[model samples]
Target: MVTDRRSEFEATLTRTAEARGQEAGAALQRASLLRDAIHRFIRNRAAVVAAVAFVVMVGFVILTPWLSHGSAYGVDFAQAYKSPSWAHPFGTDEFGRDLLVRTALGGRVSIAIGFAATIAIMIVGILYGAISGFAGGRIDDMLMRFLDALYGLPYLPFAIITLAIFGTVNFWTMVVALTIASWFTTARVMRGQIITLKENDYVRAANALGARWYRVLFRHLLPNTLGVILIFVFLELPGVVLGEAFLSFIGLGISPPKASWGTLAQDGYSAYEAHPYIIIIPSLAIAWLILSAFFVADGLRDALDPRTRET
Candidate 1:
């Protein structure tokens, strides 16, 4: 009986050592992958430049309100339609509001909407997809069919309807509208990924070991989908920004006394013929942000690809 007990203790020790070894190996592999991804991202010059530009742009918007001498809302009729000068580098709009300050402030609103809406999309999409994929059978079919029904709805119109329902045109309102309209695609992508990942050996082993559903889903499945999720995030940002801009341009987004790149464009449109800088400046800002985001997304895609070699 003593010999048997000793053997059982030895087996337990062996099992514990193997488990530790596996955990250590996984940690090492994750570190190596992260290191390689960073190296790959750094090698992409366009991505590096774009990233720097994006950060600079974000900082410029965040700090502009504090640093600018002029107010975004304050009007000075005497300064109206002035060309780019030392006092106002981006010149003044028709109302003599400083274009530079307006542009910067508008950026804050636009970028904020983009990030907020994207975050909502990620949470809703990831959870819905994971649950549907993991559950499968009738539930999967029902959820997918509902998603398909949503897919048939037009994006802009749906957002507009949602906005109308909220009875306001503000930051949170716009975020909700965009989030409601945008989560469908993300959900589809995540669902496809989860469906494949759920069949992997690690996931099966997790189930076999009696791990809870949430643990298997969150700890095991979700982590594996990070690369795909990150790529989608960068790619989605530009779209959300543009969408916000479009809504604001149509007067359905940010209202008067507040600004967004889209609203700035709209304000500048009529006066563009007389003072092209009004429209040109904001348009260029929008283009710059979109291009930068796209480059970063491209870099992330290549970096995270397992097939990508160090060469």
Candidate 2:
């Protein structure tokens, strides 16, 4: 009787523990999984500084122009080449327009292009990669082959060629060109991630439970891959902005009256001997924006890395 009672007591304790686990598993899992990442990200000094700087820069670029009555294109030859002052803090360009206003407007355009292209690229690449990875076999082979063909093409030259053929690259045209050139990387990354994840025990369990292919891919595989994708997204933006600026600098980006940082810098370069501030200001803006993005990406990678989670 004593031995039987002891066995029953142990069984009762096991049952009680399982019941408590079932009640709190989700909450515990969520906190355990996310808390470390969040804490690490918050503790990153450079990342926090960069984040604040980026937000401030973007807001100043966008709101400064709107807050004032100055036109980015308004010419005042009388005030030409005036150095930084209260009337023109960034000074006057060759056209005698307020450099501050023009630079801010340029920032607006450059950042917009960066964000729009990244978003489009992410959506297309994720879908293509998820489909290719989850539906492995001949279908996967064909899709990957197609991706390879696109990936092998020269991105910069092809974008230039497309712009030349079109003869009128507007905002939408540039967005499309950048999207086409950039999505290949995301597709490659996502495909590899999904393929490995699909073989994991959790994924296998979901499949065994009669989850549809689409559900498994989108609901399970996709979310798991998002941390990597998001990190890449920020990392890609700086490159996109730089590429757009380079094109604009060469006279191929969005045409005049619609200034980009590249155009602003290019214009500033014309009278550079007399007024270097014009060029200097826009160049500083670009560097700051790109560096800030890199800082954030580094922070994100550190936060999400499982190896670093314990620290």
Task: Show the colliding residue pairs in model 1.
Answer: none
Error of 2 at 16 (Å): 22
Q: Output the lDDT of residue 59, model 1.
A: 95
Worst 10 residues of 1 by lDDT: 15-24
What is the Cα-based TM-score of model 2? Answer: 0.88
Q: Residue 182 in candidate 2 has what lDDT?
A: 80
Cα displacement (angstroms), candidate 2, residue 192, comes to: 1.2
What is the model-wide C-alpha lDDT for candidate 1?
A: 0.89
* Highest-scoring model, lDDT: 1
Clashes of each: 0, 0
lDDT per residue as tens, model 2, 60-83: 887999886655787778878889
The collision pairs in model 2 are none
Q: Whole-model lDDT, candidate 2?
A: 0.84
**TM accuracy, model 1:** 0.92
Model 1 residue runs over 4 Å out of place are 1-24
